[model samples]
Structures are given as structure tokens and as C-alpha cells.
Target: MLKTESLPVLMLMGPTASGKTQLAMDLYDSFPIEIISVDSALIYQGMDIGTAKPTSAEQAAYPHHLIDILSPSETYSAAEFVTDARKLIKDTHHKGKIPLLVGGTMLYFKALLEGLSPLPKADEHLRAQILEKALEQGWPALHGFLKQVDPKTAQRLHENDGQRISRALEVYYLTDKPLSLLQEEKGPCWDYPTLQFALLPEDRGWLHERIARRFELMLEQGFIAEVESLMRRGDLSIDMPSMRSVGYRQAWEYLEGKCDKETFIFKGIAATRQLAKRQITWLRSWQGARLIDCQRSQSLSQRVILDLRSQIEKYPIFM
Candidate 1:
């Protein structure tokens, strides 16, 4: 069995379209490692196109955990993620392989790497009520209501972001506590040694261009068709977490008769660019470890493998 002192974890993070997934797969091919995804969007089943989840072929190539294991209908919170990831990390360590955590979900990574304060389970009734109100009153009306209850969270989130606004209000109603207070008390609580690496593209403009291109590629790959299938199910609502994801949200509008194909393409790319921007800002705030500019790094695979090996050797995980 691997002791906490011996089996160090490797965390590979980066913004969307930074080539982290391809690099992680490359490293997996070279090393004895198991991947535990940190992506929030990838957790939902049937959310393949937008979340960029590894295809079945890729999973056959390398073992990946915590991905495509949940349905959008279920409530998967960060607290729940931390619990499962820590267990998976321990399990992988027992099998004598490195637990390689990979993805772009900052919240999940932060909660897992640091620790999360205990928060009350979401009041589903309250959540449903909030959504019903939003459908009738619109996001601005709901946002206005949140401002009355929790001005701090309301100010931080945009008025049109119905999902987050509802969540914040639901938290307050459930626990009688401000979401901000819960955040301050949470952090990575483990003593296990961990190495964090980020694959950053040096050129912002280049990354934005790549983001736009990726959305177009998804379109060509039948992104809308995927949404149409879900729409036909009628069980998947736009309020679901998976549905709120970047490209899926815009495509959902087209499926709902809210937009034409042209508008969907245009808005999808714009939303993806915005998501990339948020990801970049989130990565900057991460401290420690290494930052590789994947855009400029020659032979990123070689460099990351060498780096991973060096970190393992330097740390010397003991059993």
C-alpha cells in the first residue's frame, strides 16, 4: 500500500483549447498513470461534443475516472466531487500508479487540491421554485431578487447568468449562510504532496482563434444534431447543468426554436470565446509548479514527460 508520503499526485491544468487533453494522453502513453478528470462539464453523460470528453476510443487507450459518470438530471456538487476524487486518488495509489488529475475546472481542482468547507445540500424544492420563477420573470428579475438577499454574490455574477444566480440564492435559502462565507473557509486540506502543472498558450489572440475554430469543428461534427436528440427526449431541460455549458447553451436555443442555425453558430463561438477568457483568468491566479506555453513549446510531449519524470524522481514516492 502506498503511504501519503510516497504516492504523490500530478495535477495537469489549463484553459480550454490549450491542448491539455492531448498532452495528458501523450504523457499517459509514456507513464504508468491513471487519470481522474477535473472537468465539471465532462461529468454529465451525453455531453461529449461540448465538453470535449475523451471518446470511447481514447478511454480504451488510457483509463480515465470521474468522467461521463453522472447524468445531468442528478445534482453533482463540488463537495461531492472532492469526496469521490480523494477516494479515487487513494485507490490509484494502492495500485501503484500515479493519479494524474487533468482538466480545466478550476473550482473542482481547487476544492480537491485544497479542501472544501462543508456546505448544506441544495434545497431542490427551492431550486425548482427559483427556476420556475426565472422562466416567468426572466433572469433579470431573478437577479434583482438575489441582490436583495445576497448583494455580494449578485454583484460578482452577471445579471443574465441565470444558473449561477439561482444557485447562490438557493444556497442562502438552504443554509442561511452566504456563499461567499463558505468559500473563504474552504481550501486544500490534505497533507499529501502534489505537483501542479498548467499548459498555457502564450498568445491570447491565438488561443481565441483556436477557440472559435473548435466551435466550428463541433458544428461540423453534428453538435446541433446532438442537441436535437436531447430536445426530442424532452426530459433534458435548458436549466440542467450540462445544458448550460458553453456551446450547448447556444445550440439549445436553436433546438428550442429561439434562434436560427446562423445565429446559433455566431452565438456559440462568442460564448466559447468568453468561456476561454474566464479560463485564462482563472489559470493566472494559480500559484506554484510549472507553466508551459503549449503554443510555443517545441515537442510539448517530450517536455511534459521529462518534467513528470523529474518531479517523480525528485519527490520519490515511497510505499
Candidate 2:
């Protein structure tokens, strides 16, 4: 367990393709910091090109925790992320290294910082029943039902967000209460000092262009082949959480003859931009976090290090 005197944990968060990985590596080179990934997509093994996972050389030089730890068929929940992150943070602190968490998974970050409600474990039978209903009536129909019961959560979630939608409905069915309300009742689980930083692009158009270029690079690196390899496993499908990721989903559909190459490229780029938009929304609403505009400045890693050093000087706990 992390004691009150442990050094503060540092979190570096940004949208997809925002150069967070490079910044984290620079920080590790300069400071005694160990990184723990907060990304949900990077957890699955064999998901590299689309996820833009760190290269094998990069991982060897600057190791990261919680990456490539699960099979594509396995499911990872925010609650489980909280448990795993806490343990990693504790272990890193014990080794006298600052815990630096980096990634784009906003929900995992929220669950880690704010804690989770005391909800019951997922009942697979109930979940299967809900999925069956979704298959019959469609997920949009289920979203409509969720709106009637938990309008707030429904409004927060996208109509096509099958995993979250099913979880919300399952909570309502089991407890007759709202998941949001239960979440509000919970307090932060780990209260040791912490610092959070968000990287935002001042020019939205520039970020969009970057997203497009990166997707093209992924394609050049055989992203389609990566998806095809996963599909050849005979155990994965588009419905699984891993396949539902931004670029992978579009690739899977295109491979299945659902769309042409032009449509696939367009959808993949659009999906990545949509994800960045949502991440920006979350960053805007986050309190007590410093926002760094990536477009306005160069050498973000040095800037972050200076800021962190300032904090460490003021609060020895950060040291």
C-alpha cells in the first residue's frame, strides 16, 4: 500500500497520436519515472499497428506496465484497471521511482482518480441476455430504453457504445438504481499527492491532418494485414471490444467486404478524429489539471520536466 509520505504520482494524458509516447520516453530518460499505460486498447496482444503501440526497441529501452497484457478475447473493465494501477503505483513507489501513467483512456483515468462504486460483479448470464435483446432490437433501441431509465448516462454515452450501454442497463436491472448515482457516492480510493497534465492541440485542423497522416502510415505498415491476422484466429469478431477500436474496426469491415477501400480509409480517419474530439471534451471538463497546447510550443518534454521540477521544489512529496 502507498503511504501518505510516498512521492506524488504523475499522469500525462492526451488524445490519440498526440505524441504522448515520445514525451513519456523523454521524461523517463531525464527522471526516475516508470510508466504505466492507461490505454484500454493497448492491453490486447497482437494489436500493434492500429494501436500504434510502442516499438519493440522502445519497450526494451523504456519499459511500460499494463501493455500487451491480455488476449483480444478477454475483457478489461475500469474497475480492474483501478486495481491493477494501484498495485503498480505502490510497487513503483516502493522502488523509489515516481509512477508516471500515460495514455488516452479517459474512463480508466477517471476510475483511478475518483474510485468506483460498490457495484456487483458482472453477471455473464444477464449480460448475454441483454446482448441477445440488442441483437433482436438493435443497440440504438437499447439506448432508447436506457434513456428512459438513466437518461444522464445515456446522454453521456454514444448510441453505438455497446459495452457501456449494456453495462448501464445491467446495473439498472440488478439494483434498480442508476450507475451514475452510485458512482457519485464513492470517494477517491488513493489520496496520495498527484499531478495531472493534458496535452491539447491549439489548431484542431492541424490535429485532424495529423490523424489522417498517421492512419496512412499505419496502412503503409500493413495495418490491414494485422487485422486479417486477428480475424484468421477464428475466435475474434467485430463485436469484440478489441476489434471495436478505431482503426481496427474499419479495417475489419473492409476486409469482410462490407466497404470499399475508399470508404475504409475515410471511415478510419473520421473515427480517429471523433475519438480525439471526445478526448478533448473530457479534458476540458477535467478539474485541477494543467493543459499544454501542443501546437503553440515545441519541446513539450522539457516544458513538462521544468513544471514537474517546480512542483517538486514546492512540495517535497513530489520528489
Candidate 3:
């Protein structure tokens, strides 16, 4: 029933361990589509086990784009993701295939769909000055300053959230304007139609169990060793984006002697649950997305596939 002149892009969104990848693979088998990973952690190489990245065999078979495209030492911004995903969407459409973007990174999805804020670029000197002040008075002091100038943004940011606080202050210093005002100017949205669906588990308890099990599986998969190996690289730090990922951050802290083994596991699982909670919260307020409530479904089965296909068929198709 898909009825648009332009090609339609498919978005398969879900929280951590919500069967997004498996569902996407199954959809690919049935529809003429290409998969693009929307995950922030999946962009870094050498982060497979911790990130639950697709295996080499699975990726080779399915051909996921934008995975393992950067090293853990580097950084990729949401703006970059918007550019890459838009180009990939256009290319996939040119190839006569729908682009299926699947992942838990709601920020990337939102930026791609709603466009980005017109924030100023990072100034190294300004950031260094902010960091120096933070070193002397601590980040909480900066938070107080932020509250005075941009109380709206300050209300949302944690006092210890150095990165975001620094960026917000830097924006104020550069433009002499508050960050909140600039964000309200939301740049430009994508033009093509998109078919959006998010897998919403009916039971919260079941989702938590899945998250705990997944974290345990990650441990069994040498997740600790993976972090250790990356740390040994002498280039990565806990503050780096890749190392700051949910599990990786906790694991890195454990390795740094900040916590015991049991505490590490508990914190890791808890952090993952928090991440899933945030993702679900984002989807709860997502506009133009169908929330498919599935019961006792960790992985999408034949029944789910057929049901989803039928739902997809109900939409208008490109002629």
C-alpha cells in the first residue's frame, strides 16, 4: 500500500537487546532493502564484544553499512552521521532498494529525521580554557555559571557532565547567545517519506532479564579482555567517546581499580538498563512511529515476520 513518488526508507528502532538486528535481517530477506547501522558504539572498530556488534560472518552475509568505520581513538559526531545516513539513503534508493536503518541510538535517528541544531563548532582554545577553569574550580562550578546564563540547558545537564557543559559554555562564549535559542532554530528535515517502527516489549521485567543476560554474555565473550586490549593501546581514554560507551565505560572503571568485580558486573548491567530506559523513553515520544507491542518475543520469529510484513503491506507503495 506504499503510495509515494519518492522511495520510502525503513527504520527499525528498539531498546538494547530488543531484537532489532534479527528483525532487520529477516526483513531484508523478504524485502529489497539494504541495512545501515544507526548505532553510536558500532561505529568504532575493536569494540565488537562490548557493543554487541554484528559478527564478521553475519555482517558479511547481511552487508551492514557504517559499522567499524572508525577507530576507538577517533570521534564521530551526530552531524557526520546525518550526512552519511542521508547519502546512504539516497544511494540505496538509487539502487532501487529501501534503506533499513536499525539500531538503538535514538540521537542519530532523531538528527537524521528532524535535522540538527545550528551550534557553533568546537574551539580548541576555548575548550582548553574551560577545562583549565574546571580543573581549578571543578565542573560543578561551571555548572553554576551555566545555570546563571542558560538555566534551561543547565537544568537538563548534570553538574558532573563535563563534556556537554563545556560544549554549552563554549557555544555561549562563541556566539554570545544561549545554546537553547540556537537549538530552537532546527535546521532542515529530510524530504523523503519514512516507515518507522519500534519494537516495544510488553513486559519491562522480561526486558531487564534480557539486558542482564546480554551483559553476562558479553562478559563470557571476553568483554573484560576486550577493554583491556583497547586500554593497552595507549591511545584510548575513559573520556573518549568509544570508551565512554555503556559497558565499556563501566568495564574501564573496573579495570582502573575503581570498583570490584561484582560491583563492575552490577554497574555494567545497571548502566545498560538505564540506556534501554532512555531509548524507550525517546521512542515513547517519537512522532510518526508505530510502536509494535510484542509479548514474550526476544527475537522476531516467523509469526512476527509475517505480521510485520502484513503491517508494512498496509502502507502506500511507490509506483
Clashes of each: 7, 0, 8
Off by over 4 Å in 3: 1-5, 129-169, 172-184, 296-319
Candidates 1 and 3, the one with greater TM-score? 3
For every candidate in turn, the CA RMSD to the true structure comes to 5.3, 5.1, 4.6
Among all windows of 10 consecutive residues in model 3, the one with the lowest summed lDDT is 310-319
| Rank order (by TM-score, best first) | 2, 3, 1
Indicate whether candidate 1 or candidate 2 has the larger TM-score: 2
Query: Could you give me the TM-score of model 3 versus the true structure?
Result: 0.82
Off by over 4 Å in 2: 1-5, 127-188, 314-319
Candidate 3: deviation at residue 54, Å?
Answer: 0.7
Residues 1-319 of candidate 2: C-alpha lDDT, one tens digit per residue: 6463446889999898888998899989878889999999999999999999999999999999999999999998898899899889988888878899999999999998888886767899999999999999999999999999999899999998999999999998998998777767664566878899999998889899889999999999999999999999999989999999999999999999999999999999999999999999999999878999877557787889898887767644435
- The residue-by-residue lDDT of candidate 1 on 1-319, one tens digit each, is 3475456888999888888888888878887788999888888888788777788999888768988888777768888999999889888888777888998888888787678877677677888999998999999988898888778888899999988998888888888887877767875577677888888888888888888888887878877788787777767888888788888888888877899988988898888778788877888888775888888656888988887777677644421
User: TM-score for all predictions?
Assistant: 0.81, 0.83, 0.82
Which candidate would rank higher by lDDT, 2 or 3? Answer: 2
Q: Pick the candidate with the highest TM-score.
A: 2
